[model samples]
Target: MGEPLGFNEYSAGKAIVIELKGRFDASVALPVKNRMRSLLDDTPFIIADLGQISFIDSSGLGALLASLRHASRRGGDLRLANMTEKIQQVFALIRLDHVFKIYPDVKSAVQSLKE
Candidate 1:
């Protein structure tokens, strides 16, 4: 019911960078999860840019966890970047900030993957 998610893709060496925008909650988590699941087959490293994500819920957290598991199973990873203060605090409050590799920006996320 809130603003729908926006997706943008970028290439960073061997990593795939994806930017997410809007309310990242139950309203849109499934579709986003499906899309990210598809990338697990071929992509190795992923960076999820969260600069424009205005909100998140448990479902949204599940989607990210699912993606991380999928990627890790295939010896890859899903990193996070550009988190808004709100999103950042939510992640911290949930202790998920330690679960995922977080970067200040997309470039840093991609760079970490390269190293």
Candidate 2:
């Protein structure tokens, strides 16, 4: 198993921010995806704060993509913020940066939703 993941959720403007900590991999992907999916019931717009995430794998990426698709279907979107260097590299290498709207911080992501 990998390092256990932690989540801290809060509301900001019209979006829900889910702060992710620890390693994001197959070990925790299902739970993380489930949490994001469940939160969709409350609101379609979500901001995934990845500042504290130390690592990620393909499964983790899949989870985020799945949640993003779900949000899009509901006429909302999933945004990313506070990404670490490692996360940024992975997303860039995979071209996921073009797929998801990434922001420098959670505040900016929330602001973008208003526009």
Candidate 3:
């Protein structure tokens, strides 16, 4: 099994900032999904901070996409920020880079959601 993923949340006014660390793969996808789902229940905006995310795989990407969809359906918004080069490449390769709103940092991503 892979090491346990770590997630921390901080509220910036009305926006929820979720900082993700460690590797995100199949083993941890469900947990990530559940945590994000719970957070979205009350928050109208979410910014996933990937600055410390060391690795990602297909399952990780799927979890992000699912979160985006869930947030959008509820009239909220989800955005990715500080994605590592590896993860950014995956998004580009899969054409997801164009599908989701991405920002260079958490502040920008959160601000974009408000607009």
Best by TM-score: 2
Model 2, 115: alpha-carbon shift in Å? Answer: 1.3
lDDT of 2 by residue, 75-103 (tens): 98999999989899989888898999999
Q: Poorest 10 consecutive residues of model 3 by lDDT?
A: 106-115
Question: Compared with the true structure, what per-residue lDDT tens digits does model 1 show for residues 15-95?
Answer: 878889888888888998888888766687888999989889889999999999989998999999999898888888889
**Model-by-model lDDT, in order?**
0.87, 0.94, 0.87
* Model 3 bad stretches (over 4 Å): 1-3
For residue 46, give model 1's deviation from the true position in Å. Answer: 0.8
Model 2 alpha-carbon miss at residue 93, Å: 2.0
The positional error of residue 62 in candidate 2, measured at the CA in angstroms, is 0.4
- Root-mean-square deviation (CA) per prediction: 1.4, 1.5, 1.8
Q: Please provide, for model 3 over 53-101, each residue's C-alpha lDDT reduced to its tens digit, 9 standing for 90 to 100.
A: 8888889999999999999998987888999798899888889999888
Query: How many residue pairs clash in model 3?
Result: 0
Q: Estimate each model's TM-score.
A: 0.94, 0.96, 0.92
* Candidate with maximal lDDT: 2
